[model samples]
Target chain A: MSYGPTPWVQRHWDLRAAANFAAGGAGSGLIVVAALSGARDAPAAVALLAGLALVAVGLFAVWLEIGRPLRALNVFFNPRTSWMSREAIAAVVLGVFVLRAAWLHATDSPGAVATGAAAALAALVFVGCQGMILRAAKGIPAWRSSATPWLIVATSLAEGAGLWWIAAAAHAQGTRTGLALFGALLCVRLFAWLAWRRSIARNARASAAMAPAGTALSVLGTALPLVLAGVAAISTSPAVVLGLAGTAGALAFGTGIAFKIALVVRGAFNQGFAIPHMPVRGKRA
Target chain B: MTRWAMVADLRRCVGCQTCTAACKHANATPPGVQWRRVLDIEIGNFPDVKRAFVPVGCQHCEDPPCMTVCPTKATKKRADGIVTIDYDLCIGCAYCAVACPYQARYKTERATFAYGKAAAHEAKRHDPDRLAVATKCTFCVDRIDAGLAAGQQPGVDPEATPACVNACIAQALTFGDLDDPSSNVSKLLEMNEHFRMHEELRTGPGFYYLWDRSEETGGVPALKRLVEEAMDLA
Candidate 1:
């Protein structure tokens, strides 16, 4: 019952917050990556639509996490001091740009590239704000470090590339670029995750729970995904390349979701209350 | 320049948990929720072991991480160094709950009683709407404000003081204006050897612990000081 000095958190943020953050990061990354790649055709469009839908669902999940869902609008009222508010504003900007891009493409208009670029920027901002939300919470020593935001953004980049690769895997015409991008993003994710784990391990107050997630992320998330994507990018065999790309996509997305759950859930152990003195066994004075 | 603070004398505490009960009764906290609690930890090896009682709730820190990360501006610190959560403004986002380094905040979705469903006492005590929001020790702000308005002195008047301070059976807890050197808490801090919880975090907690006079001042050697110093390095 006693937390000693390091209180084990009783799950302040349940599965809902984790799901929302994962979806928001992966979905936003998907939109940005899909746009930058030359897959502006049917598959990329599908991924964009799905990504936007996931983001919308993600926002709804946050609404469900609160006590009064009606008061959720107040979350966006304070952008000056609150990263959560800034995230809402960025979400709004992203929604508008993404919708505009979709409309232009639907109407066969010429301004989709411009709209896509804007949407990508907004999505990146939203994802960054989400990471800053965790970084801003100083109570969780594992999350308060400077590397948390970078790790989150890096994971999002890999997840987005994985998602885009999944959508465009059927057509080998534009798969190499997405696969190569996926490998690069995996490298970024690995570096950031390693740095994050090192920082957390060095913290005197941080629990040892996340050291395992770091290993997990490096293996299943970065190493396997990169190896599979690298092979797919250079492979001449269509069957082998497509199979490997699918595996890479699965591994990348799984890593993103798993690492986020571990970070937001178990990484949230309280730093514990500290004391300066102890009473002796036999003394009242 | 009114800064409210509490001074807990470790030598006087018997860990009776009277303050814990009094806080729950005064706040009408839910059946499982505790606004203030006394934790008993056994320190040192068995042969030289000693039991220490720590009365903990909120530090009500100078740099309250809860207030900084609050998305709705619902958590705020008043001019008197008391941190409070505005129930009306809080969207029940538990960010404040997690942001608290002391794990002081509590959130309960349902109003339950000790015996069964809502008893008559629970019905009278419970604020049904407070279920979703972040809640912690308010330092009995309502009583302090009402008592001040009525020209009663806080820390001296029972009605004006925090319920936990008033209910302490051992009189181990002292509360007063930290801004005034003449106040009970301030005088105690000046006259005794004291340390704050998590001082290295630079939170500048309003709560202080007066363990004992140091050995250099002709008192017993402070094993507690050695333990605290080693932890600070860790």
Candidate 2:
């Protein structure tokens, strides 16, 4: 009565939510690479600092999205029941490792691997929890598919790999290998997305919601990035390789944000009322 | 073990929307927000078309997805089967609204009036605390609780019944403890050809609709035979 005769969606989460996903993706992505890259010098500092900064920005973005930003801490009250609360906890743990990694980088510590690995694991949880957040929304069938987590994981990894490649390129470190991993992760995302779309297509409403977004994910989000990476892969010239790889990284990051925007904004539709039998003149609907 | 439920007899309902009006008056919901509504559904091709009135609202589901998804644990189901939202605890994230298949939940941050300005009656019934939070049909929890404290039985006493049920002019709506076989709702459900919406979801909704008395209402013999095992277990 309030919204629709058919199901309706709550238009609460908007661009701020998209920002949350993008910033969180970039942050977690940076930490993931920083943790695994085994970078003991200048590039490690760049990754650690940027990663922590983006995570903070992402947290703030979500905090701003809530009606009562001051009441944000109250979300911690239901960790046992809510993925959102768990995301907050994971964010805190990731922050701790992030700080330690930054300190290790600044202090020129040789045992940076432990701190980096801790940060990376925490980063994975932080990003994967966002997927869990979507999976927990049982109302939107499109978000609840089993493939959602894998897709998010793949997206996060690709975004992180892309950032590492960019940072490495900027620091004159070899960028080709990191670009390869980023490309591979994007491929993982493309496959997982296809699986997700197939699984959710069984539901009529979910299929309707996924149609446009799934197409965008397949064509603009997946194919465009991969094709660019292939061009970068084949190029023997230094400038050509760097520029193409940079463009590929940029596309991969944009795709991550676009996919989430489609999900958090467009793909959210409520399941409407249903009746087993349609009512007729002298009958019940 | 009080499980409150509602049973609507389609034959008796006139689709006058008195229940919808009564709920709005009782709840003082802001403009565009309704706690109860009667859906007029028409079916069949032109010449053979038929229409029916369906009272749709929160089912007070046994396994409410809204409750499961609330990040602040603001949405909860009572032991007595009334689903409610703790407004103070809710962050107005609208997660519960999206999770509810029934679309019974609503979130409104802005204050709106029916006819430009808030009328005296609306102003009287308005709940300021309800703003910026997920709100829905509580089955008139306040009335039930107050009546219980005053030694009145819910669904039995007029003062305790939901505003919608009490205002049904045709007596189409019955309210009672579903767990009590002697109760009006339970008795109505047992005697009539009744069904709950989205039963396949296994949410065990408290609202039941008595559609028709037709012998064919049960559908084919094969269908009956297929359900016989489950019915036998029940």
Candidate 3:
């Protein structure tokens, strides 16, 4: 009478999946922290350190899911043809830039422009790779569209801005950049909301399952932080009290991840052919 | 200045994954991860089935979103229009990961080391930082850099042909400078019915695919239908 496990869900949510969710959450948190702090001189440094640590952990989780880990390098040979290869190469380049920046900071050298540019490029490629990975999967209609990547990028930006505001309250010099980042986060959230609404409305099946949850997270989980950040920005409140904005921001981030994980798991399998039920007959024979 | 680009004659593509394999070998990437992926798409009902293989990678766009959102600025576009990433500088925020519409970037995980002891050793050795940042195609920047230094054309490295081009047994992948009118890629673009991925996004992708004249000829109709349906819903 009842169908078995749903194809949409992975067999057992393993370390890899957990790590992915955690990484996504942490990455978003760090970026938000950096944006809130406006530690321009050290924002990239902090972000790189946090980002890499999470990525390394996430990668390890992925290895746990697979049989062969060494063959991973084989993913990078096809920049001319493969998104996976390009992603590998980009990660290497981004790492180099991060190290260079760190070295410059340590040596008191003036390499911010070069390093910042490199990080920017790396960020774009990073998001692109995420979308490509989803697109590569033929079955997941939810992830195939261009909107997926854009949505990812928008969420990161929003989270980064939220984090920046929180950190800004801790430092005297970061107030301006923190507020600017808050504004940016608000804008990105708006864009992301629009994109999600559009996508959900467009796909009936996707809308039926994922859209309601996505809308809740985007509207409540994602929006609440920005609203708090905005309030903190405008109100002449004490820095200590305003710090609560960051806490709110972090909570919003968790909600965002919840929404993302739900969307991801729901769309894992293709809409397989509906099973036909057997007809019960008695007198016909 | 090396303005890197690629042109694919979709007409000639038979959906073979030579380019994928070539890329795998060239990059020495770990398993369960592909730098280059060939998408085999089928359209229409059983009686009127239509299949198309879409090979996609980093478009290396002129206004790359990844660059705009990077809190660390680890990725960059060169003066010659080739987008490159500085691996050492990347903190792996994956902010760039989300910014990109094409989904061209990836987060290299530590699990990559589990493929083999050798790969694990290599990961420990080469990427000691260990998944500390975002990554994607650099248009073979190392090869291009070396080629330029050697007074040869950029992206002309015999051993490093951007894995997909080399792996493409169908000989469907063509790499060259789009700026040069004489380049094979340029000529192919001019002669064939080519299209870039998500052309509407206006990312100005570095890669192009030539559609088969004899096939449905149009772009993936199913996608087109989806787009239309999305528009109506919106």
Best by lDDT: 1
lDDT of 2 at A110: 71
Give the Å error, residue B133, model 3.
Answer: 1.9
Off by over 4 Å in 1: A1-3, A170-173, A203-207, A279-285, B214-234
The digit string of per-residue lDDT tens for model 1 on A58-118 reads: 8888788887678888887678888888998999998898888877766667887788788
Writing each residue's lDDT as its tens digit, candidate 2 over B82-183 gives: 899998898877767766767787777767789978889877777777887789998999999999999998888989999999999999888999998788
The residue pairs that clash in candidate 1, if any, are A5-A272, A6-A272
List model 2 lDDT by residue over A37-69, tens digit each. Answer: 677655676688788789889888877777666
Error of 3 at A214 (Å): 6.4
lDDT score, residue A162, model 3? 46
Q: Score the docking of each candidate (DockQ).
A: 0.48, 0.45, 0.02
What lDDT tens digits, residue by residue, belong to model 3 across residues B17-66?
77766665556555544566665655559895655666666778877756
TM-score of each: 0.92, 0.90, 0.49
Q: Model 3 Cα displacement at B95 (Å)?
A: 1.7
Show the lowest summed lDDT stretch of 10 residues, model 3 chain B.
Answer: B212-221
